[model samples]
Target: MQRKVDPEGLAAAAFLAFLATAGLFYVNIMAAIVDGLVSGLAFTDAQAGQVAAVNTYGAAFGAAVSIFTIARFDWRKTSILCLVILVAIDLLSILSTTPMTMIGIRTLHGLVGGLLIGTGMGVIGRTANPDRSFGMLLFVQFGLGGLGVMFLPRLVPLYGVAPLFLSLALFSLVTLCMMPFLPDYPPRSVAAPIKKAGTVQWTPLVLAISALFLFQAANMGLLAYIFRLGTESGLSRDMTSGALGLATWVALAGPLLVMVLGRRFGRFPLLLAGMLLTLGGNALFHWSQFGEVYLLANCATGITWGLVVPYLFGMTAEFDGTGRTAAAASVISKLGLASGPLVASMMLGGGAGFAELINTALAALVLAMLLMLPPAIMLDRSARRPSELLPQGKVTA
Candidate 1:
């Protein structure tokens, strides 16, 4: 019933994903700028935290919107609208001088950001290799985030954070450039089970999804707050940035390794390996006071993240399906995105220090690890076998 998968279409999906995540990374930079803006406006840290929450709330709501939004509107129109909304909002962020305005703009951002990530990711996942797609998508996230991080910090001084978002407006414009060539709908060949498998269980997939939440929550938390923590511990802004910007790029290794091995293994093992690397990185950052130590920690984090995230997405699409599968991920992604700052606020503030943050993260990660054991026991041997893991995971009806 379906036709052959288009390689070019898949490639376009990856590029579009790159751009969407660039917007997210831009927001990440904006998070820092929001703090700076808050300090300038005399808002308490609590108020600043609230401003960040506005974006998360928007994202969570927007993600929910995607489930209905995509179904009602065509992907093409939806994408263009999201970009248009983001462009206006980013520029507005530049104009914002007060907390309320900032909150309003970020809330808008959360909404649009959620839509872009949800839909854009769905496109790529449907097109690319499912097994490798997971690693591949995260690969794009890191690359885009890196590009945004490099450019946003430089732009913030010249035009401010809002203007930096305007730059995202420019990047979103690029997504349009690819649109004429990008695939509008999932290929007819993408086999989706309609009845939710009345008797067909989804325990493995559920476990994988849960693992995704834990991993992302843990990873994003470090990404959001580590710069502040490192700076507090005597690292300069540039040093922290380098760790994030340069060292974070090192995360590419996981995916690259997966490219070679994805055809050879299961997503869960790769996921497990990624978790170990993340654990190691966090430990390194915890023990070392030196900037280089944190630098090394980021490198480890980067590589593992690159692989783990894509693998998770790919696995999700396989167990479930891509269209709405990506929509489901947005729930945890949004929570983790907002949770990082809030968790940090609770853990590190009031002179309670980094101990709480670091300890809590390590503890959660352990819990995440514990969560994975069930899948190991329940999934099939081939499902667990490395050589059997297909890089792609589209439903083959």
Candidate 2:
């Protein structure tokens, strides 16, 4: 019997996936997170970046661990526990007096968050349309991230970064309330021989994961320093924050376009266009001294960001019906996020300017786009079928 997609189930699942990945929302509002640590906590720029990097590093580790457990664990219970721990960690962050202490606790927070997001990706991969599911994920991230970047900086001076941590705790609390409403998502069952047969798809999976990592690293490396980039270019804090917020809001178009199109037109064309736009956006940062240019650069990049990520995830999900590849891709994504800050911080510390950083990011994006081609081509060719495949645990010959 053919199964129909339940709209209500899709909504529930997308929301749950969002909540699960919400633990890493700090990355979406990277500028504000960096600022909060700097102004509110008095950490140096490099220290702040290091802290952010380690948090994601821990997340990468946790995500790697999740690849093993994603198909075995009860997602609802796991989400509940992770959210609870995340809330506790956020509250504890408020008490952090030193960078070392904050870094340690944040790493722990990242570990738990990574596990949640990895599991979330697994859920997304199981959906009727992984592309739409991932689009929803980006839509929510950009929406709330816009609000956070716009307002969090304003509150920081008045409340001393307390709002930052508190906001995270509040999000967790809200997610906790939404927990009971989530439908049960059991572990994917697979026959052992069928799993073995699926190994032929690993080559494409690896390529897709590589592309995602490079794209994320390139984007995040710039984002982690965008605030600094703006100020150094003589833009006011208010202007920078406003531009970021508005850009994020506008970025919704990217994901919306993805949802509307799905795989109708294929992946590489959109990815290629998006990547070129991203490259141009990064190039525009070379003119960040101009306000209009700064604003335009952010909007361009943010839109492409929203457009590209879902396709990448959807591409990875194509290789394996069991969601394991998607889960592994999540791990790589976190590693890329973790690496970006470290790389940016090093370049800055070694006397490299923002131009150098942006250029490096541009190069990464180009390479990432190139890496995406083979997998995108493979998936596009294979997709000439009645419909997408489900996790039946066996590969057809």
Error of 2 at 272 (Å): 1.6
Worst 10 residues of 1 by lDDT: 192-201
For candidate 2, lDDT tens digit of each residue in 1-397?
A: 4333353466665675567557788887788888888888888778888888998998888778777777778777888899999999999999997989999999999999888877777666565455566556776788889998888877877888799888888888887877776655554454443444444467777788899999999899889989878878999888888998999999999888877887788887888889889999999999999999999999999999888888887788777755556656777888999999989888887888888999999999999998898888776766675144333443321
Q: Clashing pairs in model 2?
A: none
Whole-model Cα lDDT of every candidate shown, in order: 0.62, 0.81
Runs in model 2 lying further than 4 Å from the true structure: 1-14, 70-73, 123-133, 187-204, 319-323, 381-397
lDDT of 1 by residue, 1-397 (tens): 3232354456654666654563364544533544345434555554566566567767777767766665566776777778777877877776677777888878888888788766665555455454445555566656666665544554444455554556567777776666666545554474443433232226766776787777766666556666556666788656666667776467677778866776365555666777787788888877546978878887887788666665665555555533445557668666766766666655544555665677777777777767764554444354555334333333421
**What TM-score would candidate 2 get against the native?**
0.87
TM-score for every candidate vs. truth? 0.80, 0.87
The positional error of residue 150 in candidate 1, measured at the CA in angstroms, is 4.0
